[model samples]
Target chain A: MYRALKTKPWISLLAFAAPALVFYVIFLLIPTLGGVYYSFTDWNGLFRSYHFVGFSNYVEAFTEDSRFIYSLFYTLKYVLAIVILQNVIGLGLAVLVESRMRTKALFRTLFFMPNMFSVYISTLMWTFIFSTAFPQLAEKTLLHFLDQPWLGSSSMAFVSILLVSVWQGAGYLMVIYIAALQGVPRDLQEAATIDGATPFRKFLHITLPMIMPAITICAFLTLNGSFKIFEVVYALTGGGPGYSTEVIAFNIYQEGFARDMRYGYATAKAMILFLIILVITVTQVAVLKKKEVEA
Target chain B: MRKRSLIPSSLIVLLLIIVTIFFMFPIVLAVVNSLKSQGEMFKSVIAWPKALQWENYKYVLTEVHILRSLYNTFIITILSIVGIIFCGALAGYKLSRTPGKVSAFIFFLFLSSMLIPFYSIMFSLIQVASGLHIQGSVYRLPLIYIGLGVNFAIFLYHGFVKSIPRELEESAQMDGCGQLKTFTRIIFPLLLPITMTIVILDILWVWNDFMLPLIMITDYKSYTLVLLASTFFSEYSTEWSYILSILVLTSLPVILVYLVFQKYIVQGIADGAIKG
Candidate 1:
């Protein structure tokens, strides 16, 4: 029977995984290796001749690169703001819909609607609302104070991106949290209520604890997405107002293709960004998994 | 205590209303602006149109080759979805069943790519793409779509496949069905919900994708809807009525699909991102 067992699990696994494996290796893994290799050389994106200059790319990017630091700081600011706002508002919307309310589906659709639009187009739509419609409305409504150069001003541009990001994302996150809220077992809520638990107390004791896993997931997504944001910022402002809105992705994009070629250096900056994200994502996922267990 | 709780509730309501108003602002403005004529647009941006210009949408649909662009988007999106579902489901099926370090390692590599900011290697990928002899033709978009899409598809497929019992697959194999047949006949049907999720998610994404189409496909006539709309904005940035109409037209396909796969999308999103 043992000799008759001619099946090979490894071969089957290899066969099963081949399509994804081949595509991944060609498109993703190959490019990643190419990135690491090119980071050492000063290859003009369009040129053929290249000489390796090890560690120089990374060293210069860290110490001599002013825009790199600015990009880092700018991205961190956007990440901090978007990470908090997207989650708070999303969680709020989720809790509201979970309250056995009327028009739940309607609200869900309205909220989730923006995620369906392409971010670039959504940014364009917001650009109209900001530069055209909002200003257009500011003339008639008593809310004359609402109009401004939302995409133009260096300061207010932050708020403009933040508003669009939250509008586009919060609803999707709300739907995510809504699912977790439903899974919370109504009996626990009822038990807390029977024990003379106030709404706040019951929520603090039962609801919050139970939804920590959802919170972790939402926070992770928001954080991951916000730091690497490019499309919305590109569409909304194009990192204008003296490039004050420039984040790391846009900066890398400009260095790579949007302007004069710096493919090697651009890849270096990209690598740093990747390492930073990889570290944070791993740490957050690990810590959150632990908290999910402990809670 | 009850009053304090009520206060927080009202505060949350206020916050939500403010956010909702901001969220709905663009859609409302698009609808109203799409109703206005060119004269109406410049005369008073806030003023109501004397008569609705329903012709704006008609113009976008017919003259702009909005229908053609929609066909192109539909082709790319559907192909990408089929590719994603096949490769994702196949890899997911084996990875979940086979308990091995190699399989687990491959899964982690795929998952980690999701974290790497796409911009990191996006330029190089485009270079490789453009270097391909057929890259200039409309052929390259599907390759790009598959390249970017598989990461998330694998994520969704892996999660759902784990929940499916492996005994079902083993039992089917005992009856002498080939792996491919077992997949199509047995596992594939069982994966309907997750398939729905992958299809809808991919549709929603690839249909609306603009930046890729913008950079990769230089041929103006062969553009996707989102790319067409963006280029339209770039050329006639001041054409408020036309732009608004195009926006409405562009959003329809996605909203239609969303209506059909409503539960799958909402639930899959929850399972994939929110619930972990």
Candidate 2:
């Protein structure tokens, strides 16, 4: 056996790859294929038998299921908000922190601290702030506007979710942006200053182009991440104010696990999410990669 | 000239300071209010506690069995990381070294799976886990995480392996070192930098992950810190002080780890983002 293995490269490959492949097949690969297969079927999880029902699950999700449709639109709104705001604020904070000489590390640490906690933990913390702290702060201070029903009202709940997400997520993108900012050539910035390029102009022409790759990366990260938004909604609002704040992942969870054990139906919704993410991310990366090359 | 520049710089500093306060306020509020009595917290959430209520922490520690959750989390995280590194490094190294259509196709299979979001696979994965009787066991969840995580780890390792020259492995083989021996003895040690990057990323992920454990681990004894804290939060929803304490306590471990590994964690994120 040893002599045979020594001579045959395929044997060596099998030996090395078997451990990972076995587990991967059992857990990830099979499940992925199983999900796609189940999406076309009509098996409630309790039933052993399921019949193939092609595209009906998909059709129902888009046309028949209003809650799921609401969640789809809600998630898109969230992804758009998060992708734009997270990148902008992240880049802004990265620039600010990078500009400082003495306090760069301190500011970065402070800004990135919230990310160290779980989103659920952060949401719980913010829940306290929105519910209890803000109300009291409003009463005590002159800032009476702080007393709004942050999670109670539908519109405000969306804003509250967005706020908590950006607070937790932006720091991650900042770290990426900061790394990108460091790679920008110092001489170019100094030359811009010598040529009397205003700070804004320098950033627009010089700094922004240099960090296009980072922007692409940050955009991808936020887009991918916010689409899968679950814990924040799960903890903060529970898709509250009448499912107004429900996200795609949460909707799927509700359909599959919590409310209905309509495994086939939920699996269809999950596949829809996967396709949506795949299309959007591919488009984003393609556009950004083009921008990166041109820059 | 100096004075002219100083004004804008001071304004920038002020702006940064205000933003920093906003970023830190939730954590500071949680910490401060966690130390206050319920009535005091109600009266003034911003005010410092007149007397520090150590009992909140004591109550959570003693009554809530948070330490058990912490231990369970530690075990699962460590095991998952170890399993991922082991499986990932072996396959990644071998695949990168091997030259064939088979190797290329296998690598593609792993890489493409990364695009399949967890929500998509999760329902089926739960079914698989139950079919195999792998669910609800703290020991077995790491096996699932290994499955989910190895692809990314293999990606990182596959990329990193290209930087290492083939001569080292060639010479080891020439010196009568077996394939497994060469990997364990020589190649694995050289793979430390990327390994550190993987370790940092995986630790953060597996430690704080709430969803998988929530679905998998039904028994209270097997609850991860995040799951337990969330359960505790809902059970005592109106007890602000206690909930705040639980939040702070749950986060304390990760915070300490982050501070200790701050530089590496940042480097890991940058590396993972760029390469990934």
Candidate 3:
């Protein structure tokens, strides 16, 4: 046995891979496969038995389920907003903060401070600000426009969710953009400056091109995260104002856990989300990667 | 030119400071209001409490058993971290060292699975967990975390191990150390830096994670810090003092961890995001 093990390298790989593979399979792999399988079933999650429904669940999710379609559109809208805004704001902050000589680390820490809190916690805190503090500020100060029903109306709740997400998430992307910005050669920027390029010109020509890779990563990360947004909507508006703020994940969650134990149906919706995210992120990454090479 | 630039630069600094306050508004507000009576908080959400109402915190701690929930969170986070590092390092190191069709295929398997969102598998995961009789137990939950978490950790370690020279491990093996011994004794120690990176990233992921814990843990006693705070907030939505205090308590550990390991956490995040 020992001699055979020594000769066969597969044995060694098997030994090392087993521990992780066992857990991965049990927790991640099996469930992933099982989720796809169940997506075709009519399992109510009560009985051991389930019948194969064969794409009806997917059909129901798309055609019959208006809420699902609404949420899909809403989530796409959110993903678009986040992908654009978070990257822009994050890149802006990163550039601004990196220009500081003495206070770079301090500002980075302050910006990233919100990221340390759970998304749930951050959203809850913002709920108070929107629900209570905003009204107070609007009442007593010049910020009267803040007195809108931040979480009580559909449009307002959408804006409220967007604000909280960007507030919590921009800092994270900022950190990434800073790291990427530091990679751009200092001499190149100095040369551009010596050629009488303004700071904005230098940034646009030299700095932005250099950080394209980071931009791609940030865009993908933001895309993935915003598509999977649950905590913020759950905490702030609870997808209320008549489910107007319901994103795909929240809708799936409601189906499986809250509304009914429609495990198979929820799994189908989840699979749709997975496919959407996979296709979009892959396409975005591929396109951005080509940009990186060109730059 | 110098005079003109000075105005813009100072203006930029002033703008940043203002934005900084806007960023910190929720946290500062939460902390300030947590220390006030409900009546005092009602009078002015922005004002410093007339007197520090320690009872708000005391009530959360005593009545809500915040410490117990903190313990549960720590137990899950730490154990999961330990498991992830060990399993990830072992698998990553071995996978890196031994390159062939099998290893390549296994690595690809992990890499592809990274694209599978948690929600997709969550419903089925619950079924599997209940079937395995591991659901609703705090201790057993981290085992699932290790499974869910090890992929990224492995991805990190697999990349990191390529940087270490193979000669050191070969020399250790020549010294009569078995593969496992060579890994634990010789290879593992060299993995400290990347290990620290993985540890910090996973701590942040596991500790601050809300969805998985909310799904796996059903019993009140087993609720993680985020779950507990969320449940409490929903139940006591009107109790601002109590809710704010619990929010502060829930967030304090991660904030402390961030402040203490600012450099590593930041570096880890950058590295993890770019590489993984």
Candidate 4:
């Protein structure tokens, strides 16, 4: 028995993985596939009777209903702006803190403090800030951009969510980037500095390339996270100003849970979102992973 | 050059100060606003409160019954954290020790689970949970939580455990220690750093979790602090003072946690983000 145990290492591995595998198959993989299957038919939550309507559900989504496609486009815009801005701000903060400043730890705490709070709570607080705090403060000082209705319009609403998301997300990513920045060899930096290379030139060359791996991970996280964003949007705007802020995830949620619970349609919409995310992730990983290695 | 430095340096410092206030002003606003009566809060107190209101905190504990919700959240968070650590450590140990085709296959499945968006599986999960008669109970929540989070926890553990030298286990084996004894006595203590990482990660996520609980638990009896605060926000959005107050109190626990364990939490994020 001892000899057999020594030889069959895979048996123990298989046993260790059994619980996770069972959970995934039952909860994740099966449900997702079932969701796709349900999309083909209009099966309400309560009914055993089901009629297979073929591709009409998808057909309606693409042709008859413009809302899904429009939301997809809006969500894409929101994501692109957010992912790029969040990364830029986060990288900047990392660069700032990596300079060995005296207050780096204090600044890091202040920056990361937003991330510790839940989004729903933050949004509510911001409602007060935008409406009351900023405007009140502006009355007494030159920094009075607070009187504007930050969440009252579609375009500004978009900017409002983008700002909050970045504020919350950047600190977390800054920690990662600072770690990556530390891993950059001080010897090389010294060599460049001694050779009369300006700080800008050195950063543009050494820092950027060395940090590419961390950038890739941050991009992946921000991309997937932005795509899945619902709570912040829901809390901040309620997908309001005439549904201009409705992302697909929130749309599916509103479809399913609100009103009469059109679960079948919501599942179909969710599957569409699933495919969008899957395609985006696979493409980014395949293409960017190579670029990262090259850089 | 010295003359040129002073202006830009001051300007940069000024910019940073402005941005920091921009980042944290809402939290300050909420804290100040929560302390005032409805009329006073509506009038917008941007500075420190004239007098701190103990009643707001009392309101949350009593009227909101946030205490009970806190108890429920505590039960779920503790159980789920314990579950993840135990299962993740056990599985991680086995995966590190055993290498072969089946383990790789299982590992791949776990990896894929992380990518599959929650919205995709959530509908069917609800259906399945409803069918299984596990809805509204704490027992059901942990399984779903484990399904979603255990992969990341296991992944962290797997990486950390691989660095543990095999020699210690061999000596234990020489002392006639069984595999379980070697794992528990020799191996478990060394896992403190990784265990802390896993615990902090799970706590942050499980504490802040709203989406999962929103769908799974329908009863107000099982609602978490975040969820209850969210409900309060929606219902009393017009009551800016009340909304602001709840928002402040809602953020207190997480803010406190972050302040306390921020070193480990930041390090955990750095490791997870940069390494993988």
TM-score of chain A of 4: 0.92
The per-candidate count of clashes, in order, stands at: 0, 0, 0, 0
Error of 1 at A151 (Å): 2.3
Worst 10 residues of 4 chain A by lDDT: A1-10
TM-score of each: 0.93, 0.97, 0.97, 0.93
- lDDT string for model 1 (A1-295, tens) is 2321355878878888899887787778777878888888897877889899998999999899898889889998999899889988898788776653555776777788788888887888888888877776777777788778887798999999898899889988899888887888877877777787888787777878898888888888888888889888888888888889999988988888777788999998999998888887778879988988887
Q: Write the per-residue lDDT of candidate 3 for residues B1-276, one digit (tens) a residue.
A: 221121267877986898799799889999999999999988888888889999999999887878889999999999999999878998998898887888999999988899888989998999899999888888889999999989988998999899999899778776777788888899999999889889988898899999998888889999999999988987999899999999999899888878998988999889888876
DockQ of each: 0.53, 0.60, 0.62, 0.52
Docking class of 2: medium
Candidate 4 per-residue C-alpha lDDT over B2-39 given as tens digits, one digit per residue, 9 for 90 to 100: 11111245655765787788787777667777787766
Alpha carbon lDDT of residue B252, candidate 4? 74
Q: Tens-digit lDDT track for model 3 on A1-295? A: 2443264677878888888999999999999999999999998866778999999999999899999999999999989988899999998888778777589999999998888899999999998999888998899879888989899989999899999998998999999998898898977877776788887777778888999888888988998888999999999988999999999999999998887688999999999999999999999999999999999
The candidate that wins on DockQ is 3
Clashing residue pairs in candidate 2 (N, C-alpha, C atoms within 3 angstroms) = none
The stretch of ten residues in a row with the least summed lDDT in candidate 4 chain B is B1-10
Interface residue Cα RMSD of candidate 2 after superposition: 3.0
Evaluation by DockQ, superior candidate among 2 and 4 = 2
lDDT-superior candidate, 1 or 4 = 1
